[model samples]
Target chain A: MKLNIALLPGDGIGPDVVVQAVKSLQAVADAFGHTFHFEEALVGAIAIDKTGDPLPEETLAVCKKSDAVLFGAIGDPKYDNDPKAKVRPEQGLLKLRKSLGLFTNIRPIKAYPTLIEKSPLKKDIISGTDFTIYRELTGGIYFGEKKISEDGTIASDLCEYSEAEIERIAHLAFKATRSRKNKLTLVDKANVLETSRLWRRVVTTIGKSYPDVELDFLFVDNAAMQIILNPSQFDVILTENMFGDIISDEGSVIGGSIGLLASASVGSDIAMFEPIHGSYPQAKGKDIANPVASILSAAMLLEHFNLKEEAETIQYAVEKSLEKGVVTPDLDKNSTYGTNKVGDFIADFILHAE
Target chain B: MKLNIALLPGDGIGPDVVVQAVKSLQAVADAFGHTFHFEEALVGAIAIDKTGDPLPEETLAVCKKSDAVLFGAIGDPKYDNDPKAKVRPEQGLLKLRKSLGLFTNIRPIKAYPTLIEKSPLKKDIISGTDFTIYRELTGGIYFGEKKISEDGTIASDLCEYSEAEIERIAHLAFKATRSRKNKLTLVDKANVLETSRLWRRVVTTIGKSYPDVELDFLFVDNAAMQIILNPSQFDVILTENMFGDIISDEGSVIGGSIGLLASASVGSDIAMFEPIHGSYPQAKGKDIANPVASILSAAMLLEHFNLKEEAETIQYAVEKSLEKGVVTPDLDKNSTYGTNKVGDFIADFILHAE
Candidate 1:
């Protein structure tokens, strides 16, 4: 297969990590006998600095023409602290998501056995924690109409969901359930909130077509506790934008290191994979930040294209790297390797996969 | 001191636990030389079964006449599984909160030294974790206007908050800062939701009055992660209704045992104390349910009345019981003590406390 992949190495440690991801991908392409082309585009704060536009017109054009996007972290402390700034790095990413039609975000949290003891959670409890969270990106409370009174005393955000919006994501989650564990837990507060009720109603109706999948529901509050108490109970966790935003972050803690998680934001037309961590401005040129999340993200990008064997190859390499302790300071403060060296080790492992 | 207390043992384990709370309170009364009047009221599923109303007029009257109300868990599987049932136990509790004007709910999560290993989290991460969550009980999406379109194609819940709502809870949490670590973390989705932005704006302004209490903010997503990652960093966490519900439950996991959590709901006129766990219908009448939460709730009730010494007496007794292994099956399966025996041990300790 031939593909054009757009690399958005936005800012800070993003460039460093994306380099690792690119190296791993290049190694994967060589091993799998696939033709691949990489096109670089400036985005986020770098784009903001160079062209005075966070999402340059040329950058969007390049992304639109590519087969998929491999997004690195975005955000600068300057932009973060300046809430009044009109043009920001995050806006650029949001616009790209909208333009690319990336409606759903898939975050897969797997507690690696080697790293389970590193987690704040007990090793016995979260050792086998493996679940994916399906969060709707384009709809629900985040994109809802926001209003405040003139006196700034009254403020409101409308959490709305249409049948179509619920059905699309529900189908994706239910269909994915068939490939993994048959249990799908829909987290919502249906007993009180109207939107949650609509979610329950829509998801239940869509669930009928997939007789093989066992459907269950939990109020968001209870789901929050369940995530910590027995995360192994869940397989595919489907929730709305706001609940997803919170629950997925909560899920991040189970893996012990946020640096070990990767995510895929996909729609019908285009898919983008990225690390779940943010741009740590302080770690920019330090060569100390973890590159595993980005490498795993590259692996997710492969899985998105139905390159299962290639994806598994990368995953196995990552596991072996972890097992061998060929890691950065984030995982081991006394480790010998830096960001680039770890990336090299992963690429080397991929090139010589069993 | 003299006080009148109302006991609402709603359903199932509710009765079993409240008996323990009452025993502890009676011990406190004996230890402190305080005159106490006690009243009992029916509520929840039992109320629904007997009176066809979840919140009967007499129950509300008894609560109103008391200085403070002690609430046990509510909810029955029969009412839970039957969605078609109009009168439910939860509705009774909701009505009580409404009629009593219980505007702010305070849940304190504390990891007991002896029980820290029971937590899913590592001992070092959550060893000294202790924080209180102040969740606005009467407002936000739960009480907001809810709607389903005529064709049922769209559903929405308006998450609205006024300056008054935020102010009342802010004052309570800020006041609490004086007794705690003097740090307050406001959890909201300010970067996305209008209500959260409004919260940030209001909290920022109100923070000026609390110059001594270090004020910080976290997006709800980050807050969720932070609770599991670094729970000790928080002192007083103030949030809206829904965020509070979810985050507090997540906080419960750090304590290792959900049955150890106690909560209080207060307004200008009245206050209610309860164990955070729900009625375990399966454990109903088995005398095997953990009674520590209820005993701790009774301690909070004393704290509400400014009986600090009295409250600590019960707390110390409960702690001693845990230390001596005089617990129910939930905390230690090998323990011979039942719910009533644990309550007896705690009460005996209070009676003999120096």
Candidate 2:
């Protein structure tokens, strides 16, 4: 099999960690007898500095023509502090998603056995916790019509949803449930919001097609509590833009380290995988950032193409690294491994580990 | 001082726990030598059964004439399970808030020294966690105009905010900080939503009036993670109704049991205090429901009327009860104390404790 992958190592530690992910992918290609072509593209702060746009036209073109896109982190402290800045780095990723028609953002949250002690939650609560969040990325309040009164006293944002928007994500989430735990929990404020009621109505209709999966509902507020109290109860959580933004971030805490979380954003034809952590500007060129999330993101990209064995190999390698204490300082302060060393170890494991 | 208190013990265990709160309030009146008059009103499922209205007209009138309202829980499993129930028991509370002009919902989440073992989060993560959430109750997406398309496919809810709505809650939250750790964190999605940006702008302007209190900001998503990561860092969290609904419930996890959480809804001239937990129909007549939340709410009611010493007395007694293991089954499985027994202990402690 041959795959053309567009690589956007955007800003700060993005380049450092992304290089490690490339090494792992290269190792997979060699070990599994597959052909993988990589094309580098500019995005985020670096793109802004070079071409005055956070996402250069060539970068979007590169991504559009590729089989898959592997994204690194975006954002910089310089661009972050300035509220008055006309162009921001975040808008680049947002534009990339919109331009690529990426509608579904998938995040998998799991408690790694070796890192259970690092979690804020007790072992009993966070243990056996494995859940995937299917968040609608493109629609809802964030992209809705925004307005302010002439007097600058009243402001509003419309949280609108169409059947098409709900249907696409509902199908994805239901499919996910069949592949994993056969349980899907739809999180919404249906009793209050018409949009939520629409979500419930649409998702319920879609659930009829997947009779093997059990579907249930929870209000956003109660869902927030249940996530903390008993995270293991959830399998695949489906929600809209805002609720997903809050609960997924809340769910991230169960894994103990933000550096180990990976996310995938997909449209009809294109899917992009990236680390959930921000580009730590201060860690630039330090060789100290964690590369596991980036490497795991590479695994997600493989799974997107239905390369299950290849994805599992990468995941197993990551787990082995944690067990062997070949981790960055964030996961183990006594460890001497840096970003490059961690990537090398995972790649080495992929090639030789039995 | 003389006071007229309206007591609304609506349904299920609502009457059971509310009677416990009344016990503490009566204990305070006796010890503090204050004249008090109590009037019971019908609301929620019971109100629907007796008067065919969730919030009876007479009940609203009683609440209006009172100095303060001490409310119990609402909702019944029968109403909760039936989607076709036109008059939900929950509507009673919503109508009550709208009628009384209760614009701010205040919830204080604290990790009690003795109850730290009960929390799902590790002791280090939850200990010393003391923060207050001031949620704007009446405005934002919950009350905003909701629309369903003619064909019933598209739906929308407008998340609108006025400077007046933000100002009232901001003032209450800022004033709260002066008495707290002198830090105020305004949670909003300013970068995305127009309403959130308006919130930031209005709250930033309001922060100038309270220079003694330090003010900062956090995006709602980040705030959700921070609440679980490092809850002690926050002093006061002020947010819109929807964000508040989510995070406040998330914050409740740090204190361990929802049965111990209390909330107060306040307007310009009137305030109502209630336990945050819902009425448990199974525990309606079982005498097993935890009464600490209801008793703590009575403490908030006293504090609302400038009866600080009375409030402290109730708080101290409740803490003593927990310390002595005089708790319901939720907090301590080995404890044999029931709801009434626990309330008696707290009332006795209020009257006798040094």
Candidate 3:
């Protein structure tokens, strides 16, 4: 098989980590007797400097032509703290999601047994916790009608959700549930918000088609509490964009480190994979940012192509890397290994794993 | 001082808990040599059953005449599971907030040293965690325009915020901060929501007036993660309505049990105090419900009325009760104390402490 992959190593440590993901993907391709064509493109702050646009037209074109896109982190502290700036780095990623019609974001939260002690939660509470969150990315408050008064005293953001938007994501999440533990929990504030009520109605309506999957509804407030109280009870969680943003990050705490989580944003014809962590401007060029999230994202990309065995090999390599302490300082503070070294260790383990 | 307090013991274990809170309040009044007048009103499911309106006009009238209102829990599981019902017990609480203009809700999350082990989080992670959350209670998506399409295919809710609304609560929170740690963290989705941007602008503008108080901003997403990662870093959290509903519950995790939390909703002329937990319908008449939250709420009511020493006495007694293992099952599972018994212990301690 042949795959055309677009690589967007946006800014900061993005380029350094993408290099590792690319090397690991190359190893996966070699072992599986496949060919992967990688096309590199610019995005985020660096693109803004060179092309005057954070997401250049050329980048979008390459992403459109590729089978899948592998993304490194975006943003810089220079752009982050300056609220008065006209152009921002995050706008690029938001635009990419809208242009690509990438509506569904899947973030899997799983606690690793070996790293349980790293969690703020007791081991008994966080262990055996496995759940996937499906967030609607292209709609809701993120893309709503926003207005600031001429006097600048008042501001408003409209949170609107069309039934079609809810239905599409509900269907995708329902299907995802069929393959998992067959339990789906819809997290919303239906008791308070009209949009939430609509979501409940649509998802509950769509639920009839998937009789095998058990369904439950939790108010977003209670859901936030339950996520910490009894994370093991949830299998798949479906929610709107804003709630998703908060809960997915909260979900990262279950793993004890946001640096280890990766996500896949899937649309009809195009999909993109990236680490759940942000661009750490401090770690730029330091070779200390964790690359396992990006490397694991590459594993997800393989699984996207129905190469389950290849994906499992990458996952096993990640586990082995953690066990052997071949990780960045974030994962093993006492270790002397750097980002590239950890990536090299995982890639080599992937190549040699039985 | 002469005080007129309205007591609304809504449903389930509401009456039992309110009874304890009232007893504690009586002890405070006697200790402080204050005259007190008490009026009891009906609300929630019980109100609906008798007057056909969950929040009857008479109940509202009594609350208006009172200096402060004390509320027990509301709602029933019967109404919770039935979505088809038009009127709910919650509507009564919502109506009360709107009518009374209780725009700011203050919930203090404090970890008790004796009860730290009950938390799912490690003791080291949750110990010494003390923060107060000020949630704009009357506006945002909760009161926004909700529309359902004729075909029931689309649902939308408009999240609108005016500068005045944000200003009032920001001031309240800022004032509270001055009395405590002199730090305030405004939680919003400024990166995405127009309403959040409005919030950020207004709060920042207000922040400039208080040079003594250090102010910071956190995206709602990052705030959720930080609440667990480093809860001690937060002193006072000010957020809009919906975000508050979610984050406060998440903050409750640090305190080990939601049953131990209390809240105060204040306006210029009127204030309301209540335990943050809802009616535990299952524990109704079982004598197992925790009354500490309610009793503590009564203590807060005393403080609101300028009875500082009286409030301190009640707080000290509640702490001593916890120290002596004279708590409800929620706080001490091995203890066989009943709801009335816990109230008696607190009341006795308050009298003896004086």
Candidate 4:
């Protein structure tokens, strides 16, 4: 099979980590007898510096024409601390999602057995905690109508959702549930927000069609508590954009490090895979930021294309790297291995794996 | 001073808990040289059964005329499970909050030295985790314009915030920081929600007035993570209604149990105190529910009225009760004390204290 991949190594440690993802992807392509072509594009602060547009149209074009886009990370401290700046790095990523029709963000929070002890939570609470969050990416308040009054005294964001919008993501989540534990928990604020009520109504209606999947609803507040109290109770969590954003990050803490999680933004035809971690601006040139998340994102990209064997090989390599302690300083601060070394180790593991 | 306190012992464990709070309040009044008048009112499922209105006019009148209100738990399994039921118990609580103009909800999360071991998080993470959350009670999506399209295909809740709305609570939170460590973290979804941007602007503008207090803004998602990752970093958390609801519940996990936390919803004149825990309908008739939260709430009420020594006495009594293993089954299943017994023990401790 031939795949066209657009590579967006946005800013800071993005370039460093994307290098590892590409290396791992190359190993997968070589081992699986597949042809994978890559095209490079700029986004975020880098794009803004070069082209004066955070999301250059040329970058969007490359993503549109590709089979899958492999994203590194976005954001820079300069853009982050400067609230007065009109153009920001995050806007580029949000725009990319909107432009590419990547509406469903799947963040799988699976705690690795080797790293369970690293979690701040008790081993019993953190162990066997595996769940995926299906976050509705395009709709809700993220893209809602934003207004600032002339006097700047009032600001409002409209949280709107169409029935169709809720239905599309709910269907994907339910399907994922059938393939896993067949349990779906829809997290929403149905008691207060009409959008949440709409989400609950649509998801419940769609749930009837998938009888094998058990469905439960929780108010967002209770859901947040339950995530920390009993994470094992969830299998597939479905929520709107804003709730999903908060819940997914909370889920990241369960894994011990946000640097270890990978995400996939999927639409009907195209999907984009990336690490859940942000660009570590301080570690940009230090060669010490973790690249495992980016490499694992490449694994997710392969799985997205139904290349199960290739994806498993990449995951096995990551596990082997962990077992051998060939990790970046983020995982083991005393370790001598740097970002490139970790990437090289992972790529080598994939190549030599059975 | 003479004070009329409206007591609403709503449902399940409500009566048991309120009894203890009233007893503690009476003790405080006796010790502090104040006259306390108590009035009881029905609410939640019990109110629906008797008056067919959760916040009956009579109940509202009693609350309005009172100097302050002491609220017990609301909601029952019977009403909670029947989502289709029109007159639910939550409505009463929501209506009460709106009617009383209880717009600022103050919830303090602190780990007791005796109960720190109960936390799922590591001791290091939970050790210095003392912070207060100020939740805006009456605005944002909770009271926004909710609409369902005539065809039932679309639903939306407008998340609107005026400058005055955010300014009122932001100022209060800033004042709180002045008394604490003088650091405030404003949690919002400014990157996505227009309301959040408005919130950031208003809070940032207000922050300038309190130059001694260091103010920072965090996305709600990141705030949720940081709450568990490094809870001590926050002094006072200021947020809108819905975000506050979720984050504060998440905050409970760090303290070990929701039953161990208390909250105060304050208006200009009227204030309501309640335990953050929901009514455990299963433990309704059983004597297992913990009364520490209610007892502690009464302590807070004392502090509110400038009865600092009396408040400290209640707190000391609660700590002694926990230290001596005189707690409800929820706190220690191995212990033999019941709810009423625990309350009796604490009250006894307070009265006998030298």
Best-fitting candidate, scored by lDDT: 2
Ranking by TM-score: 2, 1, 3, 4
Q: lDDT tens digits, residues B1-354, model 3?
A: 999999999999998899999989888778778888899999998888889888999999999999999999899877778879778898899899888999999998988887888888888888889899999988888888888788877677878899999999999899888768999999998877889988988899999999889999999989998988888889999999999999998998767877778899987679999999889899998999999899989988987777878988988888888888888888877999999998999898888787
TM-score against native, each model: 0.97, 0.98, 0.97, 0.96
Q: Over the stretch A1-354, how does candidate 2's per-residue lDDT look in tens digits?
A: 899999999999999999999999999999999999999999999998999999999999999999999999899878889978888999899999999999999999999999999999999999999999999999999999999999999999999999999999999999988779999999999989999999999999999999999999999999999999999999999999999999999999877988999999999998999999999999988999999999999999999998989999999999999999999999988989999999999999999863
Interface RMSD values for the candidates, listed in order?
A: 0.8, 0.6, 1.1, 1.0
lDDT tens digits by residue: candidate 3, A230-301: 888899999999999888888888679778888999998889999988888889999999998999899989
Among all candidates shown, the one with the greatest DockQ = 2
Q: How do the residues B1-354 of candidate 1 rate in per-residue lDDT, one tens digit apiece?
A: 999999999999999999999998988888889988889999999999999999899999999999999999899999999969887889899999999999999999998998987988887888789899999999999898899999999999999999999998999999898888999999998878889888888888999998999999998889998888888888999999999989988888778898989999999887999999999999999999999999999999898888988999999998999999999988997999999999999999999885
> What lDDT is reached at residue B15 by model 4?
86
lDDT of 1 by residue, A1-354 (tens): 788999999999999999999999999999989887999999999999999999999999999999999999899988888969889998899999999988899999999988877887887788788899999999988888889999888999888999999898899999878768988899999988899999999999989999899999999988898888888888999999889988998999887888989999988887899999999999998999899999999999998888989899999999999999999988988898999999999999999874
iRMS of candidate 4, Å:
1.0
* Per-residue lDDT of model 4, residues B123-162, tens digit only: 8888888899999988888788888899988887777889
lDDT minimum window of 10 residues, candidate 4 chain A: A151-160
The parts of candidate 4 lying over 4 Å away from their true place are A78-87, B82-86
RMSD of each: 1.5, 1.2, 1.8, 2.0
When candidate 4 is compared with the true two-chain complex, its DockQ is 0.82
lDDT of 4 by residue, A147-211 (tens): 87898777777789999999989999999887679999999988678888888888888999999
